[model samples]
Target: MSPVKPTLKTIAEISGLAVPTVSRALNDAPDIGARTKILVRKIADELGYVPNRAGVRLRTGRTNVISLVLSTEHDMMNHTARLISAIAGEMQGTSFHMNITPYFPSDDPMKPIRYIVETRSADAVIMNQILPEDPRVAYLRERNFPFVTHGRTRWADSHPYFDFDNTAFGRIGVEKLVMRGRRNIVMISPPRNQNYAQNMIDGGTGAARAAGCSMRVMQGTTSDNRNEDIQLGVARHLAEFPETDGIVCSATAVAMAAVATLESLQHRLGEDVDVIAKEAVPFLTLFRPQMLTVHEDVARAGQFLAQAAIQAVRHPEKPPLQGLDVPTG
Candidate 1:
């Protein structure tokens, strides 16, 4: 059998020091001598010893964990994976660990948030798919829990968050289509219930109006729709709006669906129709030259979310850190 891994106790024995002394030295406690600490750290490194997370948690009254609550709907896209990678990367040097918890968006979103707070499962939380009047925001605020959101909420203006400028995305999407000489433009948007969806619509339609171009929003199709449903919706929209020269999508997945549907209808993209979308995945550009994409920096947003969570925990009374990043095609 493989031998057990080295621990603080093993270091204590090998170094001929008390377990408490070894612990303090490894932690670099001020009470320990600097020379002793240097010796212990070297030995610990040589032995490949690492601190026990449970022990550290018990000692510090902190779980040192960051909880990321996501909706099953949102997890369907590639952006979720990118965001998780970014958040984990940001926390790599810190004591905090990232834990993702997925739940059905149809269920009351507050259930999972409440569970985390009640169990103290994590030191801080990060979440996305924000609502206009978000209950999660209210609950976190009431508990004074440290949290960062990926999108804004209308419930409060003073919460730490990192959001893509959906309004700008809308405007850019419309402008791009106009520049391509496409007069009839339609946007495949997320559910109107989401605050960012409305923002995206306002930006796109507002810009279209200013440019004197014909623009319309096709309802009932959302970013969170099932793949088949998205395809069906796109097919139906195309059939109804046979004059649609351009399409704008809220997400990469939606753009993919639109492309597939257009291909099935024997519509050559970039000629018969032009498609533009906001995507977090890089591969979309590699395969889809026919589609123009606005890439959202989900990785940077993840870093900001982690940083905000840390700051919220360490300095709750400080002003909230709010940020927005523009997208690029």
Candidate 2:
């Protein structure tokens, strides 16, 4: 291996090709011939040609790096990986890259923002798993960096974003349960501070008003509850199942917890009580309660947000974007 890290310029020089052409070939663009790509790869390997993030950003006006910020842990859900992959796949021909940056959800989450600013590691950022009053969103907006959010932030009315219409999802779930002869319904929602959670509550209330059903929205705690934390809420409500009748879970965690709790309660899956929840991706199995899901198709959402950020970064004069809502069943 070469002592120095390789760069696009180094590969270009060694392979006797232009920098852009080398970039295109190394990135696996179909436009480049097999011979040139192979030659570039061989030379890149020989020279340890690692692309310098700073140089690339300076040259192309982009770091070729897209950052996906999460409010919770890095491995919060399966959607994280799926979303990143979707954006990366969509950026196949473009000089863009995508990765996730995990930050603790806090009253002041300036750490992630500071990292992005101080290091300048990202060309554009796609903030995900956000709360209603997200400081990161405010920071990015003030800084004038191109960014898109997977979830809507309450601070901004118009911005590039891709989100599910939670109100519709909540309404549909409640309506469906009421149609199935359910009278009392309970909803497990995100904390009240989340905009989507509020929307879900509104939708559920509307359905309840029309159907004459009782709906209560339970807020989540912020004390580091991974998927396991879902169980505590389920355990609290599981004993009151017959009185509850139907359930509307605001997240996959609630759905998962309900499933486990119901199983423990010896309640028949689809027969005793109907369960519906919001999901960012399709489950590997369509079994039981998971089968009845309000799918957000987060991968598609990621693709949409990625395109929006790329466009906004490239063309600032473009009209401000409204949140694109994915229709759910």
Candidate 3:
């Protein structure tokens, strides 16, 4: 038969101590002696004792849960999975738990934010797909909500965030392609509405101008629904711009399409046509070593977001405001 789960009473009985003393020892109350605390902890570890979160929540009035809000579109690109894994890794060994909630980006992205707040679903939140003037930031700040973002928003500067330096990614992407001795280059970028999209466009074009290389950008698909569209889009662009011999991709979906189109056009990667991309997940490099990629360290972004949310909740007055630029490999 399976053994019964151990509790404070079980520890007290085994240690020959009072129930209250055992409880104090487990909680590391200042009044308890260090020797007693160590003894209690050793027994608890051996017994595999698990704390009752319901009791803890009632005593502290804190859920000890962090909610991550992300877009469904990113799930296809493997970003959501990487971020969640990193956040969970950061939260390991802590009393806190991480929860992921996916939603579609809308004109009013604040709808999901309001839902989580109203339901008291989490103690803190982490959100992404930031806009220039994000209403979610304004609403969260107005309510004094404890939150962090994966990217920056112009509505506020106080909240913590971790973001990839897309401008630099764009600039460096062009540099990498240009180094391959290609003068006519084309970039497949995100929709113009996103702030990162424009940052990338400006960076790529500016760098190309300085290098005396010609560049053009084509708006690419962002959602999984249009997977084939990206491949066809690249094929069309290549057909139209026959002189194009280098490419930069902002999304993995587009990069995959670009590779297939290049093969169809009888162009060799890293030889006839050079390709580079900013990748959220690192597995792309493992599969296609010839296709050079710069990783954004989505896992580290998750770890930072997790820590930022907790700090924002516990120390609102002196919260840590962190802005991270993902390093290229």
Q: What does candidate 3 score on TM? A: 0.84
lDDT of 3 by residue, 274-318 (tens): 888877877666757788788787878888888788788767888
Pick the winner on lDDT between candidates 1 and 2.
Answer: 1
Predicted model with the maximum TM-score: 1
Rank all candidate structures by their TM-score, best first, as comma-separated numbers. Answer: 1, 3, 2
Name the runs in model 1 displaced over 4 angstroms: 1-50, 75-77
Better of 2 and 3 by lDDT: 3
Q: Which stretches of candidate 3 lie over 4 Å from their true place?
A: 1-5, 8-51, 75-77, 105-108, 220-225, 280-282, 326-329
Question: Backbone clash tally for model 3?
Answer: 0
Q: Which one wins by TM-score: 1 or 2?
A: 1
Tens-place lDDT digits, model 1, residues 92-154: 645467999888867889998999999988888999888888888898988888889988888
RMSD after Cα superposition, model 3: 3.7
lDDT: worst 10-residue window of model 2: 218-227
The residue pairs found clashing in candidate 2 are 6-48, 6-49, 6-50, 7-49
> Model 3: which residue pairs collide?
none
Clashing pairs in 1: none
lDDT values for all models: 0.86, 0.73, 0.79
Candidate RMSDs in Å, in order, are: 3.7, 4.4, 3.7
lDDT of 2 by residue, 72-148 (tens): 65334666667778887887545566777777645346787678867788877887656787777787788887788
Best by lDDT: 1
Sort the predicted structures by lDDT, highest score first. Answer: 1, 3, 2
